[model samples]
Target: MSWQMADIWENIAQAIPDKPAIVDGDKRYSWAEYEDRAARVAQVYTDHGLKPGAKLAIYSYNSAEYMEAQFGAFKARICPVNVNYRYLEAELTHVINNSDSEALVYQAQFAPRVAAIREQLEHVKLFLEIADGSGEHLDGAVDYETALQAASPMPVIERSDDDLYMLYTGGTTGMPKGVMYDHKTFSSALFTKGFEMREMTLPEGAAGFGPLTQALHAADAATRSIPACPIMHGTGMWIGAMIPHALGGCVVLFDNSHFDPAALWKLTQDEKVTDLTIVGDVFAKPMLAALDDAQAAGKPFDLSSLQMMGSSGVMWSAEVKKGLLEHIEMVIIDSMGSTEGSMGASVTTRETTESDKTASFDMAETTRILTEDGKPVAPGSGDIGLICNGGMVPLGYYKDEKKSAETFRTFDGVRYSIPGDYATVEADGSVTLLGRGSICINSGGEKIFPEEVEEVLKTHDSVYDCLVVGVPDDRFGEKITAVLSVSKGTQFDEGALNDHVRANLAAYKTPRAFITVKDVPRAANGKAGYKDAKEIALNALNLEVA
Candidate 1:
């Protein structure tokens, strides 16, 4: 069955044109208003000679226009590639060239970067600027609103489920690779298993679905979802932003850009947010700290409206989950997913037991893990190996067919999407994710996951954030090393930090050396850039290599 994303807006606008569809600070947009604006944007794209199936890149922070531009592109049947606004010239150029994007819809704040790369983007025919209050202007770019004003609100062109949307995965091994998804695969993989099944699914008519058919009847009943992470990231863009909107529910955009705990509290309390989605403890830690401060000050915000709080992108601590639950009266869920396989591979819901919480990974939902020998291991064995899957995996990397064919393969009659994450399946079928297999440290015949060490280090009082990596060691083959961001007004104590890890984890898992700085290096999605961290860690270890 072919499904067009434009149907989502059409259904919402027809049913509840006046109802609020988006809330960003004082700016509120009803379904009709948003549709009208989106249509105009589509027209604008058409006028700019951007035809259907053409690629358009959106580079901006979270805003109402971001959604408008995305839906507008869907209306035109043109693929919209959401670029990370934080990308530098080198990173941005790779995406622009890889996608062969013809137009770029960006915020005026990034005019300088645009100017720098304008000459290099040969395929880019138009630069449409979404003017922020910055009062910045580009020499050859047209105003976003002005361009839209000339175009008529043409009817949305119907697109088949086979139509493609490209999402680029964070490249720890090298440059980022574009992961393409058709509508059917994206919906079945990302929106179906974890999200649609968990919560109360909305009525069929509430969304674009007709009277409950067999396929629709089987979907989960939940209508609401929240994506607290940036829309540029996969979880944030796909699960958090698109899935919720496609369901015709409200998308609560946290526009603070910079995460301020108090601001999050205020937004939650004021907006009566139902589902709070986060990207690990980096986002949650500060909110928890704010909640603590609020309670101490006797001005605690009421977060009773929240039903479910979820963490993805990185592993969140059990301690942090407990702290967040104190403020929110709902289920605390931890999910493990990657851009390669869309969003959710496995999830631990509020119903998950305390014993389950102790385990580093959750069980697979629609996917499975296998060892190097291609044998599936029983759960709880601590026998870690490659993670493979069978589901709505992408066709392959765009343009790089060789790499794509290697990564996207079929084993034992099942097509698996293996992104090379190392994990152990528990006895009860729960999956314990060690870390990315490509970055796993093998020292003295022992496997060490950087994420495990990093999680423990983050809980340290003086450590703000940390990244663990394996550096070359003649004695152990590869020695574990940690690069950390110290908290404000704090000094690094290598011995104290090492002792802390030693108490919590095995000696082999603990970092052999520590380097402290003001901030830990990370990618746009908040995932640790181990390759970059390794470079810094190796330099630091070289001075003290013993």
Candidate 2:
């Protein structure tokens, strides 16, 4: 796994040339076609003076061209920076400029937005547009398809295992920052034994690459994954796109920019998608709703092809898991991971029994629960500790040494990345995750984490979704407020929900006020952007929030 991502793809393509690699809408690309197209993309970009180590920004929806751009950048030994499609013009410009991106590959539909901010991107030299039938083009941009067709497939360039793989994320707080990961570290963690590319090692000689390639091709079944989230997000790109591709499997991309639950189900049924990666309950609610609709209409979509459904980066409640379990017989994988580090823990649930509990995970070997003072917490200690990961962590946040030094650290000579997730190790060796420390509420000197309270609120049948934030308080310093949406026929019984929380958790931890909204605002990836939610709450309370 010390090889660059592009070289590995080349090796896999040589052995399994005809295996389907990517599917977007009606178009399907085989392994050979995928490699060839990626190479052509590489050629075109390199021809335009795109050099190795230069940053290339991908600002588009989920499409085959997105994947091609990613592979192309890797083959050219360039770093691909993921741009949040939801960003406003200022934010988008900030990301591109901050990343020092030399080129951009975006969708034709977004040409206007790109044009509006094109002058702000002083370092950008190339703009390759993917046609979405918008018929709008930038002044100096090249058509993505035309450029690929015109250029020869690039010869494999020199690449290093240490070549950067950059992903920009707004992890837990603040604006987005680029997290730089070398290929070897990212590939090793992603292509684990579970992914069927166990312990990827560089060959002793040229002969060794063949054996690994043959082994990859000899697999009887290939894993097919569909990411319901935008490919720009970590869950979509890493879990949905990269992992499946590394296994010599097919990645199915949703054609629409918006999430269509029915279309997701249809794609899974049609493609026999083995894995569906989502963010959390925002995605689950609609998907579950679609399933209910289909069943009631006497045309239930066949999800029998799915073996597992995984969610990360947000809360995935046990109630939603049970709802999905009733329809599909597959494992529900609830993972605790971050842009700054690899997965710390995972809770896998099957229909047979309740093995996965909400907010609880069996820790990975590379992770440990440590006290703030840097001492490991013993099981059953009941002491709150930060979840720290040892091996396979990112180098650091790109170019922000002070921030990077705070998040990634060396403790007693072993380096660890602590993304500020606080948790308690249970007596049974399970980790019960509290929410991020950055979002924790300190009310009257007692710290209350939002996820713990939110999870308790979700257990009530009347509640559809909820977000807990601390509001400015005169006496208590900050009062806990739960802003939530109720199920369509259920009344907003604040007292009942309050009683439920008081019973499950401490009285002080219960939300002092409950506000009912039509819906909680969520990102496309299904994460409740707490900063925005908090701002909304502050306005409702007539209190100022920082």
Candidate 3:
């Protein structure tokens, strides 16, 4: 039988009708109740003239309504676009216009931003605003809950396996481009092996079939997953939230807006969350600090219910990854993925050794690494370009044939999605992600990438966060500069930061100059906005373009 993404939910609702499906602080929804709410949301969409395959944009943070919108979109057969909550007016307008989104559902917190871009969003016909119990409303938007209440709770549409359910990639390099995925792609790429591998134990009869249904049921019964990341990025949308739901697990929403280690720990302990997905060092560092503070107080937090821990979004350093495992005493699965891919590019397993944990390669069999000349390279080859496959690789970038043709290519009669990532292929065939190739810096005669330097800089105790980039120079052609957000109470001295990097990295790779700031510029997904960072770096250095 063919796989249907919507069917995964149906199976869980039937098998575990009363099981907890989602939890947001004081609120909790059972599987049946969640489905009913999703059905009503679907009815609302249909009643508002959104047909199957129509584009609907969700511009909210992690919430019950966010999940409802996803399931509701599937039920209504509308293609849901997860808009980044942190996007400014220009960024938000670009996606809205590019995706040709017909309707937008957003929280009241972002009303001002929406109001700013509403005039520019030519394609958006309906604007749905979610109130934060403050009774505040955006001028030209309808109430979210009121619309749902007025709409019928009927499942108005049925989606086929080939119907596009997700638009995974948001084109940050240029304009946002949609990477369309169907129900079959979700079941095959995400459900089959991805969720199955995360389970501690499998049921007797649940071994062979797509483990998604059974996992959702078991997760709903046993585990509660805390998704700290926003729902716009694939890590936050698919791996962090949806997959947990596919397992019938409760999702704990961390809606603090900014990263607060103490608040996160308090939420986790209070919610009794069993599983947690850490994005990278930015997230993990604060969490570790909070844990340390708790330990120092002689009241070691009861994180006993925490069973499984994993890291995704950005790559975590070996030291940070080790620190987390040692502290938690649980297996840590570090993974690498891209927006063009269906989220699960590669993942480390429990049995993977410490040495293997540090080295980033262990990709699935379907994943491949090839050189610029299109020849495959052997494992342990220093740094080879990577192209991942299997699951729902995007059809093409929406509306940009030139980029679509270049990125989505056909080799050996099979189409492969290569989003310009470089990695090291280990002896055992695992892949270690280096960084994006497009942003790689060539300084003096050395090939330096910002990610490599940023990783080293993050290890510094005084540095809270930093972004590294290459600036045009007369002597070296391009010189490396580091812009940093230092820890509170720490001094921002360029000489001291230079010495720190010199101790860890090659002299040529270290940042030639440092600019201290309160925060590093980043996109909604915690990714460095290199262009923005470069602009800041150049202005600080008083460097002129040649």
The best candidate by lDDT is 2
Writing each residue's lDDT as its tens digit, candidate 1 over 383-461 gives: 7767786687888888889888877778788887878877777687766667777787889889888877887887788
- Model 3 ranges off by over 4 Å: 168-172, 199-221, 342-359, 487-506
Candidate 3 displacement at residue 453 in angstroms: 2.2
lDDT of 2 by residue, 294-344 (tens): 999999998888987887778887778888888998877777878877545
Candidate 1, residue 137: the lDDT equals 76
Pick by lDDT: 2 or 3, better one:
2
lDDT of each: 0.74, 0.84, 0.72
Q: TM-score for model 3? A: 0.90
Ranking by lDDT: 2, 1, 3
Using TM-score as the measure, the top candidate is 2
How high is the lDDT of residue 112 in model 1? Answer: 90
